[model samples]
Target: MTTQVVILAAGMGSRLGRSLPKPLTELSDGRTIMQQQFDNIHHAFGKRAKVTVVVGYKLEHIVEAFPDASFVYNEQYDQTNTSKSLLRALQASQPGGVLWMNGDVVFDPRVLDRAAEMIARDQSFVTVNTAKVSDEEVKYTTSAEGYIQKLSKTVKGGLGEAVGINYISAADKAMLVRHLQRVDAQDYFERGIELAIEQNRILVEPVDISDLYAVEVDFAEDLDRANLFV
Candidate 1:
């Protein structure tokens, strides 16, 4: 099956206090977050998955940074959330399984390598960190068999953070797109996935990535913390 990767890179980094968009934000390592993410995705999928980056804020910067990447713009980026950005990407994606990640995280590239293998076996799942988690992150709980039962920022005493990485099988694309479209502008992309699971449209297992270092860079402090990991 063809594998496609969609990157949600359209957000303005308001919390990071940078004029750069979140995807264009430079790390101490001199690589922008989008560059790091693209490298990882490339390493994992090689020529297997075609990648499409969704861009909005400072669209020209991202376009220049990744001239080769297919892009779907989210014109209402300032007014919408990740769900809307993802919806546009889904509409543009070819028929295939898709792997997606947020634009603002830095992590070990091997995580996606491992995720690629896991998704080949399971078809659908969310990459999660099973170590100690915080209330500030999107959290989830899994059944003993590793299928995610619930996911939310308020999922108290949950298993781990969602890590903003997820996969969907091509077989579920139509249903997934329907769920994404039903979500309101204020809701997260995860909300649609949750609705999918609730309605028995899909089953998203949890794949733990505790062995690898990954962090969503939401603020200056988060960037500092991620520096230590990289």
Candidate 2:
């Protein structure tokens, strides 16, 4: 029941005003931001999961930072969303279930354990959420029961930022690839999962991770605050 992690780290993160990719940003700990994330994940899963990081923008720095992790290049990152970035990573992963996540996102290691526990329970879909979004705009929309109804930016009363933690079981892997094919290359990955759930082919197991402290930085202010997670 080994797991494989596919981290989508191919974005330019223009919001961060950085000439480099977000993952390569410096952390207070003296390690690059991505290195801190790996440190957290490794502390949780150890060698139980083979980790593969998908790189596109400033990929060289990413390779240099985490040389042991497998790497996949996504040339389309500038034009496409994370779904495609992860698809490229999947092309190189073990055929087992995947713990798919965003490299730029920060999450508590407990969220990783929760995701793995749910996936091991024969769940077809798994995610983490919170109800603490302060913005008038909703970052994501999910049912009270934790089913993500929509991931659009316009959706109000947003459930919260998607924790970006997931468990893609082996049985659900085909569904991921098929959804990518049916949808255009530019479509976001979560939208495909929602569509699959409409066909009753996916089940989302939600973990209320509001208590966990995590953050996603696309700005200098956030970079200054990253010490909360580190």
Candidate 3:
């Protein structure tokens, strides 16, 4: 099966305070953030990777920037959050597992290489960095069986921080879609994952990539840190 990927870039990214979409922000390497993501995908999966970008805010800019990529528009992007954007992408995807990442993340291409095994097995997973856990970042706790138990920004006793790179197996995608549809409009996509885990027993493993850099550029400092890796 071809490797399917989705990039959630519909938000206005108000925290970054940029006129352009966050994914369009230029990195020190002179590649836009999304361009680097595309490069990483191609490096890992070659021509077999089918990328679908979820666009809304300044959709035209993103569409023009990557003419080859497929796009799904989130008409309610301004009124919703990642949950809705993700739902739109999931609903539009083909019959297969999907690997997705935040549009604003700047990371080592090796991160995707690290996830290759899980992708090949079609296992649902979330990339995590065990080196640091910030209060503002999405954090997670593992179950007794070593799968992800709870995931959210407010998760207490979190074992690590989620790096915003994730996968939903084709087997688990419909359950996640149902939960994503039921989540609040302002809820992050993590909420949907949590619901699926709690109610449906969907197992999502945590893929540790602490040694690799995966920074979501939300502020000026974040951009600075991401530039260091680029």
Candidate 4:
């Protein structure tokens, strides 16, 4: 089975207050966040896995950073959100399941290792963390059977917060593409997944990663926190 890894890195890091794209932000280890992500995915999937990066803010810079990666330009990246960028990437992906990761996170390589294991088991799941769920976090509620029942930042007391990493089958990817096309461009990509769950077109399992380090960089403080783990 062919597996594609899609990295969504188009948006400008306005909140981070950095002139560079979040993916290009220099980490404590000197490697950019996207470079770390590429390394981790390569470590888990080897050379066969195709990596497609969606770029918008600084296209030339991102392109130069990953010359080997296939690129999809999100022309309206400033007006849209991750959902639209991901949709563009998914549409350009190969005919198989895809491992999706937001470009702004710095995480333990084990997150990719475990995500691949879940995909190998023929399960589609979103990585979640038992770490403190703040109001700003993208939260989700899972059924007792481990399927995600709901997903939203406003969902108080969720099972865990979404780690912005997930595996989606080709079938589900088709469904998501269609759903996302009909929704608001500002919606997060997970909104489509929530709709799929509601329509019974897919079941998203939540895999816990509380024991591992996964940080979503949204602000200067978050970047500092992520640097601690890096």
The most accurate candidate by lDDT is 3
TM-score of 1: 0.95
Per-residue CA lDDT of candidate 3, range 50-135, in tens?
99999999999999999999999999889999999999999999998999999999989899998889999999999999999899
The residue ranges of model 1 lying beyond 4 angstroms of the native Cα positions read none
Q: Candidate 3, residue 219: CA error in Å?
A: 0.3
Estimated TM-score per prediction? Answer: 0.95, 0.87, 0.99, 0.96
Between 2 and 4, whose lDDT is larger?
4
Question: How high a TM-score does candidate 4 get?
Answer: 0.96
Question: What is the full ranking by lDDT, best candidate first?
Answer: 3, 4, 1, 2
Candidate 4's C-alpha runs over 4 A off are none
Q: What tens-digit string does per-residue lDDT give for candidate 1 at 108-136? A: 99889888886687478899998878988
Q: What is each predicted model's overall lDDT from 0 to 1?
A: 0.85, 0.71, 0.95, 0.88
Model 2 regions lying over 4 Å from their true place: 134-146
- Where is model 2 poorest over a 10-residue stretch in terms of lDDT? 129-138
